[model samples]
Target chain A: MIQKGMSVIVKTVTKITLGFILLYAVYISLNGHTGPGGGFAGGVIVALSFVHIMLVFGKEMALKRLRSYVLRGLTCAGALIFLYAATVKFSGGCVPFGAFLEKSVSCRLFNSEITLPFCEMLIIGAGLFAIFVALVLLSKSDRYDSE
Target chain B: MIEIHLILLFMIAAAIVAVEARDLLSSVVAIGSVGIGLSLAFLILKAPDLAIMQLVVEIMSLVILVRATMRQDLPFSMSGRWVFNTFSTVLFMCVFLGAAYIALKNIPLGGGDFGIASGVYLREAIPATGAKNVVAAITSNYRLMDTLGEVAAIFTAVVGVMAIARRVGRPR
Candidate 1:
C-alpha cells in the first residue's frame, strides 16, 4: 500500500484551499458560456483540484475517494454528453447547430443571454480529472513495485 | 507592446532554462513559468479567454509532469547516441524556424479575409445563442463540431492512459 502524505503544513493548506479550488472550478464551468472561462478551462481546473487532494493527502486517500471505473465512466459520459448536445437538432428541430441558437433572443433571463449549458464543461472536467488520477495512480504503482 | 516584447523575451529565456535544467522538477517548474508568461501575454493582447485556458492548461500539465517525474532521480543520460540525437534535433529545429521566419516575414498580416465571418458572428451571437461572450458562442454555437471532435480525441487518449496504467499496475 502507498503510504506517507506530506507534512502537516502542506496538508493544512491543502485542506483549506482545496474546497475553494473546486468551487472556483465549478464557477468557471457554469459561467463558461458567458465569461472568459469555458469547458476546457474549467475541466482542467477541476482535475487540478483533485490532483491537489492527491498531493496533500496521499495517493491512497485520493484513490479511496475515487476509483478508475468512475473516471472511465466520466470520460465516456462526457463525450456522450457533448455528442448529444452538439448533434441534436434542439427544441423539436427548431434549428441545427452552427446557427442553432442564433434565433432565440429570449434565453437571456437565465444566462445573461448565454444559451450554452453546463453539461459539456462538467463532463470535460470529470474526464480530465479521471485521466490525471489514473496516470498518477499508475506511476505510483510502478514506483512501489520498483522499490 | 514593449511589455509584451519583454514578456516574450522572458518566455524564450524560460524555455531555454526549462530545456537545460539539470533536474526534472526544475525543468517542469520552468516550463510552467513559460506557460504563465504566455497567458499574461495573451491577456495583454486582449484574448482573455485564451489567457484563462492557457493558465489552467499550464497548471494542470505542470501537476502531471511533477507527478510523473517525482519518482526517479533521472540524471541527464550521457549515452553516446544522446549527443547525436540532440545535435540533429537542434539542426532540424533551426532549419524549420528559419523557413517559418522567411515565410512569416513576407506575408502581409491584415488582409481582411475572415473579417466577414467574424462580423457575422459578433452581430448574430447574442441574438441567437444568448452568449454575452462572443468567444464562448463561437465555441459551443458557431463551431460545435470542432469542439466535439477535440473533446472526443481527448477522451480517447485518456481512456488509453487508464487502460495502460491499469495493465501495468495490476498484480499478476
Candidate 2:
C-alpha cells in the first residue's frame, strides 16, 4: 500500500532523528561532569528517542521490538549495579556512599584516578533504562486497555 | 538584557495560552514548550545542572500527565464570568510586580560570596576524586548522601509503577 510506504519513510526519518538524539544524549552524559548535563539529562535524551520511535512506528511494533520485560529487567539491573557500587564504597569507610570514590585516592577502581566516569555510566544507564520502561508502559497502557 | 526580557515575555504568553487553551493536548504541548523555555532561562542564569534536571523532570511530568489525561474529556472553556477574568489578571499583574521588585531589590548584579564555597569544592574535587568533571565531583563526593537518596527515590518510583501496573490476583 502507498500509505504503508509513506509510513516506512516516516519511520526511517524518525529513526535517523532518534539516532542523532541518542548521540547527543551520550555526549551530554559523558560530559556532564565538566558541563551542564549528567545522567538524568542523558537518560531523558535517550528516552526521547524511544518516544519518537514509538510515535512513528506504533506502540505494538515498538513493544514487540523493544520488549517491555527486557527494559524492566535492564532498569532493575542498572539500579542494582549502581546501588552495589555505592554500597561497596560506603562500606569501605567512604561514609555516605561514593565518599572514597570522591575525596580520596584509596577507593579508585583499578587504582586509576578516573572513577567518576564509570560511576556516571552506571547512573546514566540506570536512569535511562528506568525512564524508558516507565514511558513505554505508560504509553501502551494509555491506549489499549490491558485487563 | 533585551533578549532575556523578550524570552520572559514569551514564556508568560505561552503559559497563559496553555492555561486558556481549549484543547488539552495543545495545552500540554504549550506547557512543555514553557518548560523548555524555563530550562533555557536557567542555563542563561549559569545553572546548567538545574536546567538539565528541570528539562528531564518536565518531560517526564508532561508524559505522565498526557497519558493520564488522554482517557478523559477535558473542558474546552472557562466556566467563569468576565469579572473573574479581570480579577485574575489584576492579581497576576500585582504578583508579577511584587516579584520583579524583590528580584531587583535583593539580588546582586554580579557573582557574590555564595559561589565561593562551590568554587573551592570544585577545585578540591578534581585531585580528591580523580575526576576531571567538577559537577560529577560535587554530585558523587561532596553530596554523596543526597545522590544516594535520589537513587533510592528513583527505585521507589520504579517499584510504585510496577505495583500500579500489576493486576489484582494476577499470577507472577
Candidate 3:
C-alpha cells in the first residue's frame, strides 16, 4: 500500500483544521433553511474535508479510516435516508419534495423543526465525500487487470 | 458601483495571468485568485450563498487539477492556431455581451417592479416558513423544486464521475 503522504506541515495543519472544517460543514447544512447554506454547499464541504484528509495523509490512511465499501454504503444509505426525508409526510400531510420539512414534534434537547433536512444534509454530504474520495484515490483492488 | 467595477477589472487581469502563466502550480494558484475575485464580486452583489459555494468549488477544482497535472506532463505551449482561436473567442464574447445589452435594455433594472416583488417576498417569507434567513427561506420553501432538480443533477454528475473513474481504473 502507498504509505507516503504530503509534508509534515501540511499533515499538521490538516490534523488541526479537519474537525473544524467538518463542524462548519454541519453548521452550514443545519442552517440551510434558516441561514445562507443548504444541503448542496454543506455536502460539498463535508466531501472536501475527507478529500483534504486523503490528500494530506495518503489514500491508505484515508481508506483504512473510511473504506471504499463503507463509503459506497454511506452513499446508498445517505441517499435512501434523504429520499425518506423527502417522501416522509409531516403532521400537515404534505410530502416536501423540495426540502420544505418543518419539525412539529418537540423534543427536549432538539426542538428545531428543521432536523430532518439537516439530517438529510449530513448523510448526503458524508456520502458524497466518500464518493469523491473513491473517485480520486482509485483502490488497487478496483482495477480489473490487477498486476 | 465603482468598487465592483474595479474588482471586475482585477478579476479580468487575474484570469489573464492565470491563462498566461506557464508553471502549472502557479497557474492553479492564479486561477484560485480569480476564484477569490469572483467570490468577492458575488459578495458585493449580495449573494453570500453563491460566494461560499464558489470558494469551495474553486478549491475542489484546484485540487483535482493539481492531481491531474502532477500525474501528467501537460503541454503549456499553445500551437500556432491560438491567435485565430483567441480572436474567435473575443468576437464571441463581444457578440454575446452586445446581445445581452440589447436584450436587457428594455427590461427593468432594479426599478419599481423589482422592489415590489422583493418587498412582497420579504413580508411573506418569514411568517410562512419560520425561517429567519431569507436566502434559506427562498431556496428551501419557495424554490424547492429547483433545489431538488439541482440535487438530482449533482447526483447524476457524481454517478458519471464514478463510472468514468472505474473505466480509468482498469489497466490498459
DockQ computed for model 3 against the true two-chain complex using alpha carbons: 0.36
- Per-residue lDDT value at B10 in model 3: 91
Better of 1 and 3 by lDDT: 1
Per-model TM values vs. the true structure: 0.83, 0.69, 0.78
On TM-score, the leading prediction is 1
Per-residue C-alpha lDDT of model 3 across residues A1-147, encoded as one tens digit per residue: 234588999999999999999889888877766667766677778778888887788766877898766766665665555445444432233444334534442221122335445644655566566556645545433232233
Q: Which residue pairs in model 3 clash with each other?
A: A47-A129, A103-A113
Q: Tens digits of per-residue lDDT for model 2 on B65-139?
A: 664334344444466687988999999999999999998887654457757776688668888876676777777
Task: For candidate 3, write residues B1-172 as lDDT tens digits.
Answer: 8879998899889888888887777778888888988989998999888888888878777776665333333444577898899999999999999999998887776666977888878999999878888877776666655655665665566566566665346668
DockQ of each: 0.55, 0.34, 0.36
Fnat by candidate, in order: 0.73, 0.37, 0.35
Q: Which of the numbered candidates is closest to the native, going by highest lDDT? A: 1
RMSD to native, candidate 1:
4.6
Between candidates 1 and 3, which one is better according to TM-score? 1
How large is the C-alpha RMSD of every model relative to the true structure?
4.6, 5.7, 5.1
Q: Is the docking of candidate 1 incorrect, acceptable, medium or high quality?
A: medium
lDDT of prediction 3:
0.68
Pick by DockQ: 1 or 3, better one = 1
**TM score of chain A per candidate:** 0.70, 0.63, 0.70
For model 2, residues A16-82, the per-residue Cα lDDT tens digits are 7777887887777767666667776776666666655566665556667777567666666656656
Tens digit per residue, CA lDDT, model 1, A39-144: 7787788888888787778867877888767766766766665565555523422334426454343223223222234555556667777767666656655456
